[model samples]
Target: MNGILSMPGRSAESLVDVPHTLEPPARSTLPPSAQRSLKALRLSAGFWFLIALVGQWLFAWYIAMVYARPVLSGTPEAINNTAKITGYIVGDGLGNSLLISHVLAGGLISMLGLLQLWPWLRRRVPGLHRWNGRLFLALGMLGALSGLYLTWIRGSRLSDLGAIGISINGILILIAAVLAWVHARNRNLGQHRQWAIRAFLLVNGVWMFRLGLTAWLLLNQGPNGNTAKLDGPFDLAWSVGCYLVPIALAELYFRAESSRSPTRQWLSAGALGASSLLMALGVFGAWLMLWRPHL
Candidate 1:
């Protein structure tokens, strides 16, 4: 990043793209099967994002309905009915404020962050994309900061390890957000896009957590290695896995997209396809068990 920021003249004209940039394909040495696998990988990635967007929008709606609705209705105490922790505490003005900002901003960013990735939107309405990107980054940072404060300072987490998981997520969010902005400022669109995707994943960590939990419960027909207090083994592991899994998958997509290896492409394609299937099931479980009940 210093190399990028410290480039001699640092002008757009003088800047060079990073190796990972999704440049147009050179004439392919790839066989037809590899080409087909690459195509499948792209499609599967797109499908995964599409499913994620649907789930996220539903989650945003859930946040508004469950959290924001009460505040707007002058019954902020109603939040405690559905919220696990950090709900309206009558005397804790700062804590309540942070809770509102964290959840509301979370909803906004969930909807906005992914839009920045739309190629047609970026190409056709660059101005909107830029402005939306700025707002998305701002809200994402706010959400991360507020969430960390709530988790650690306010003691909103269910378990110590869970708090650590969320804390790690917050740090990743900050790093990714900063890098995304810096790369954009440097006119390095490839790196910017990569970092932005990471920021998106990190910001959506809570959503992923809920999805994973619901999926697990549905699969097991009940909790396994779990507890009511969220101190169970599965809960502790998921604290990190929620964000890590998505980002790791994204990295695999990046590697597969860039590589000419048929084997890598096929492997990535299969992995992405399986992940999409799991995510789809998770989304269903989340909507059925977590979100829809409240709505």
Candidate 2:
């Protein structure tokens, strides 16, 4: 009764103004592995995007001039230039059409893929995200299919192992795309994100090829300095390593994030840091020795 009548001397306003006990909001926490993974990703995302931008533009520029000028103005350098294309340019008919479609769409696809991973854009402009996602998926499938055809049916300059490696990459891209779509359909955004990243890396595997080749050349002292041509030891190594290695490391990161092992966290952090530095070097090598001269 005394407790019930405690406000008897107080005005209604004073009673209502009394502070009430409420538990503070729970503090969000991430495991150490996850924290390191996120930090590494954040630190590298911008640099990765810059490298990707260079890659897309370089591809687009080389394709347009090499293919278009030859057809439009009868330029023979087109042949010489396109001979440098990793998969080798398909001169005419269906192959050319597919390759051209990929060339024209590749940059847009990459840009949209990057944008789709943006949380703010996804929340603020969901329609744009959905449309871009569809376009990215469509272009990615077409590009990978054409690449597979070129590598297998049209004859690649690499060894049989390299061709097989490329085919495996193509298959992986298809699998990643399908998994991403399924996850999106099931409303599992987290799984969708993982699969989408896998697909993005697969789609950009050519960047690694370009970067690796340039790094090889630079290390060996430029074009004639290196005995490795289209099918060298380094090329052979990177053919499978480019896609597979990245995927493996990504999976390792996800495992660490889930398990939250401190040892794994340190290992992942060290690996990611070193890899990012190497990637920057790759970009620089590719730019200085390979694409820059052409531009």
Candidate 3:
């Protein structure tokens, strides 16, 4: 597989791992205007990752304090009172185990994934990156499976539409996970990294859903198009958009980075910057309103 997929003369890792590498074109070949556009796009992407890293770490911390702590302290039932989702069952040991595993695995994955994408880590600590990437793919598959079981077999969703949305997200996660592994096994690191990114976004659909929902609620001064069942128009759209929008933005970033056209690069940078700003707003709202109160 490696021989078939890898380039004959290329032994170095993919450029995807080292976006800020002092490569030849970046240092000398590209025109000043194109270089500037590339730099802006890189900056915007860095800003987005910075925001995501902080927000997701905070969320992981929140999960640790609110969800994992209680389970560890031998009072798992307490989670029922604290969790925003229907996370605990009073008597069902199997269900409770799955719930705890899903939540904790999610928190760990969110924390670990940011490190996997760090340019310094991948460039300098290649072994750690490879090991961590393996662990991430495994956990991602497990998380997706557990989530699907909870939403469908366990009937944890608020509405049938919401369940359908969750199912789609789970399926995407599985597909991304498989493709990422295949690419990695084939030594196609560039495609592997892209699929890994898609997997990360899909795996965090629930997290993004919370952030997007809180942002919308704050912007509207209330849950204007929301209901107790979460089957409203905005909720339905948001369930899909939470993951899709970020993936679309990532695709734009990839295209812009590869394109020599300064206009396309600048436009992609603008789109990414705008989306990052909105994500920042969402993170802020989620931190203040949802996660903070629980913590």
Candidate 4:
């Protein structure tokens, strides 16, 4: 981030975009049949994105139903929606809209994840890639802004310390998004890649929240004790842990990739692989124990 540090933060025009030409993948020059098969296997360009987006849209649809039904029908009971915790949250048309927007947009943000992670797509379709990158940054900023308002002003039931953690979470997300844009503009792909990954993980911090909190509930034999609702210092701890740990892990991965040591690379690969598996397990844990039941 020395490059980022040296660049003036005050001016949006400070970063000069030095166009860098990246070499096209060898797979692109392969025989037509071979290249075609790669797409079928989702190894070529961005074809797998269709599969990923389908899953995300389905998830979004479910969330839309979960939250929207209560608000639309003017249902007095909280029903399956967590937003129904306090009647006041959904009482105002503003809070109701924000909750619905946040839930619906969550899956779309996951779609942006597909773009940032896939390098081939950007090479194949630079125009679409540039447009979507801008869209991703815009929506990401909006999501964080609205989330802060909903969490703090509109009352998300977070404890004072938990709320502070959440506020910091939003700020980090916003900062990461801005930094990604700056680096990308400067053609600093190295810095851009790292900052983009950071932003991606930070954007998905809520998933960590669900996964961590749900696992705690399961281990403690239901939502008994401080785990029941967001109470005590546990929420505060988990709120920060969810994002902070991932950010630390991202930095570790960046450093290992930059290093020349094969041993370090191997260790970093193993650790990241294990972390991905754990994250998948956490998703399942949350789905089985929390969100699915709400449906």
Candidate 5:
């Protein structure tokens, strides 16, 4: 057998002459902490996004319902001014008509605003989204221009500030929307998406203000007790807070996602957690006051 193995055509090192031991397969070696951290990040991101969406929707619905009917009745000065402004542009006898039209249009657009966040809707309804977006832009321009005219004619110092805040926000939203459309047309999806997010947040200003007021009132005991009236510095502060806070949050979230740095991610997450806690406290206080009876 040894002579055969040593033959010219056969080598002694061949499988026929030796047994080889196979090495065991290498095992995955990820540390437990790394795995846990990834899971935690994913959960945190999902939770934060959900909170933003739900909070936005609730505020939108409340505004649409409250303003739609009361503004038509012409009971409050604020509501009266809104109605008169709408009426003045078109004509008298059209005050309620204009109010209804604005509310209905605003409500429809705001409703779609929520859907724009959905990945599927954003992809499938790009054209429809763009069209509705144009309508929203037009509505904003008309509303803001009319609001400016009326503000000049009838706004109080506080009302003037409020009107200016809303108008500025409106103009910003219009610019952002237009830029988003242009970027989309140029196939610059990243910039387009960013601009769209900004526009959507601006459009949500009124909703945010309402929520902030509701929150403040709750914390202070009730709407009546809440000293922060819908005027003057309070109104301006509310508007600024609503617009700036969300944008700040979105920026932090984007930064965290891009950096992939644990420190940044944790910092952003903590800020969001604190803001959410404060909002929760406000909401709880408001709910308690709203439900409680007056002695």
Candidate 6:
């Protein structure tokens, strides 16, 4: 009887010792399915981000292409010829400088923004990422300030509202970017990641806004005569939707870090997947509209 009792204790001791005897698997030993799933998720996010980045670049390119000749030509006739019938001008020299700065900054931001989507670039080249981020922030600030200054000079109500909306978003982006850098300096990586994500989303606001416009026009079968008129209702709707959606998505991702429940995981994954899809649709749709022209 004593031997039997001792045997149970011995067995328990042996079980505890067994774990100690074996080495924990290195990261290389992570299950294949888990690794693959991680890879898939990253690839999906990268793919969607690239789509958004490219779409934004193309739009910027189109704007530059349309305005470059006129702005660079520096002739009175060219200066007076606005991109749109209702477009506003900021006189000659200042307007030309603003236009040139806007296009160049936009192009650089779009290109650098694409590189930031890659995980390796973010992790391995953090110094480069940080420098680029600073440049982007500075340019974004310049763009926003310039945009606000030009908003008062916009010819149409819709254009004015668009400028204001973009300016507000640009400010938000700058704030987020600043916060991200601050958090990173303090070593609060979670907050840094969240703020960085928010900044990136704000940077993509133009893409989202353009898509919203195209959808509105398409659903209406064509633009109404007063479509260029910025009504409070349209401006409010666009501002709320574009700003809230991505922030909400980023929050969902942040929350997923602490959640262990399968349901929460499902919800997080669903939100991420949905956001990725929306981003892709917005990007591709905008590209088709801008580039194809007939669409």
Best by TM-score: 3
TM, every model? 0.90, 0.73, 0.91, 0.71, 0.66, 0.71
What does the lDDT come to for candidate 6? 0.57
What TM-score does prediction 2 earn?
0.73
Tens digits of per-residue lDDT for model 4, 236-271:
787888888878866665554444444554565555
lDDT, residue 281, candidate 3: 89
lDDT of 3 at 174: 94
- lDDT tens readout by residue for model 6, 167-252: 67867876887897788788776566667667777766765776765655555566643244544466556754687677786666
Output the better candidate (2/6) by TM-score: 2
Clashes of each: 0, 0, 0, 0, 2, 0
lDDT tens digits, residue span 79-123, model 1: 898877668899999999999988899888877877776665676
- Taking every candidate in turn, the Cα RMSD to the unseen true structure, in Å, is 8.1, 13.8, 6.8, 10.8, 18.0, 13.9
The residue pairs that clash in candidate 2, if any, are: none
Local error of candidate 4 at residue 272 (angstroms): 1.1
Question: What is the C-alpha local distance difference test score of candidate 2?
Answer: 0.61
Give the Å shift of residue 147 in candidate 1.
Answer: 0.7
Worst 10 residues of 3 by lDDT: 15-24
* Tens digits of lDDT, candidate 5, 132-247: 66666666555544444444543422444556666676667667777877887887776766677677777766556666777766555554422333555565677677777877
Report how far off residue 115 is in candidate 1 (Å). 0.6
